[model samples]
Target: MSEIPPDLRYGDSHEWVRAEDDGTVVVGISDHAQGELGDMVFIELPEPGMNYNQGEACAVIESVKAASDIYAPLSGEIVQANGELEDSPELVNSDPYGEGWLFRMIPSDPAQIDGLMNAEAYAGQLARILHEGGPINT
Candidate 1:
């Protein structure tokens, strides 16, 4: 089973977001996403100062199994991108919710974060996908 941390909000396509007290939010792929993608090889991180709408493709994650776009979980201006992942993509597989985080942003509207799934909803979505044998957020 995937590690679904209760504190994070989840995107339907598999990204997770954690709101910070400073009005920024951290974003990354969930443990379930990396697990399904097999081993991480490279991640094209977004640039600081770039703006993207909710659900816009911002980065790309490549694994041994396949490559997939990492979308913006909310409309925002990217405040920072994780530089370490450029050198150590495997951090995504090793510690997904911590060191593997992809980017940070100042949301265009903080309330959009609230519209995403909570841990329980995300877990149920994953269960339904698994039971139905649907392809995970590829």
Candidate 2:
């Protein structure tokens, strides 16, 4: 089963978002995503100042199993990216929700966050994926 923390919001595409104290949102691939990816080898993150619409592909993650696009869960401009991942992509496999987080963004509309899936919804989606015997559409 995938780890779905109750505090974070999730996208059907597998991106997770955590609202930070300083008004930025931390973004990352979910545990289910990294697990399906298998031993991440590289990540192409968005630039600090770049803006993206919700549902846009903002980054790329490659692993031994497959390569996947990381989508923006909300419309926002990136504030900072995790430079550490360029040197140690395995962090995505090791701790996807914590140290492996991809980027931080200042949301264009904070209220839009409410539209994302909660932990229970995300878990149900993960369960469906597992029952189907394959990863989600990437």
Candidate 3:
């Protein structure tokens, strides 16, 4: 079973968002996503100051199974990237919600975060795709 933390907002592409008190939001792939991808071998984090619109592919994560794009959960400028992943991509598989975070961003429209799916909704979608064996509508 995947660990779906109750407090985070999720994107259709399996990216998770955690808003920080500092006005920046941290971004990472959901635990379910990491599990599906298998062991991560390489991760390419977006550079700080780079901007992306919601749903845009901003980073790359290569696992033993395949290489996947990590999309932006909200329109924002990346403020900080996790430098540790460059050296330890396996952290993605080990601690996806914590030390495995990819980047932090300053949202272009903070209100847009509210438009993302909550954990319950994401869990529902996850179960639907698993049980139905159909692709998510991302």
lDDT against the true structure, each candidate: 0.94, 0.91, 0.91
Q: TM-scores of all models?
A: 0.98, 0.95, 0.96
Put down candidate 2 lDDT per residue, 72-112, tens digits, no spaces: 89998999999999999999889999999999999999998
lDDT of 2: 0.91
lDDT of 3 by residue, 1-138 (tens): 899999999999899999999899999998989988899999899999899998898999999988888888999999999999999999988999999999999999999999999999999999998999885332
lDDT-superior candidate, 2 or 3:
3
What is the Cα-based lDDT of residue 90 in candidate 1?
98
Candidate 3, after superposition: displacement of residue 69 in Å? 0.8
TM-score rank, highest first? Answer: 1, 3, 2
- Per-residue CA lDDT of model 1 for 1-138, tens digit only, reads 889999999999999999999999999999999999989999999999999999999999999989899989999999999999999999999999999999999999999988999999999999999999999874
- TM-score of model 1 relative to the true fold? 0.98
RMSD of each: 0.6, 1.1, 1.3
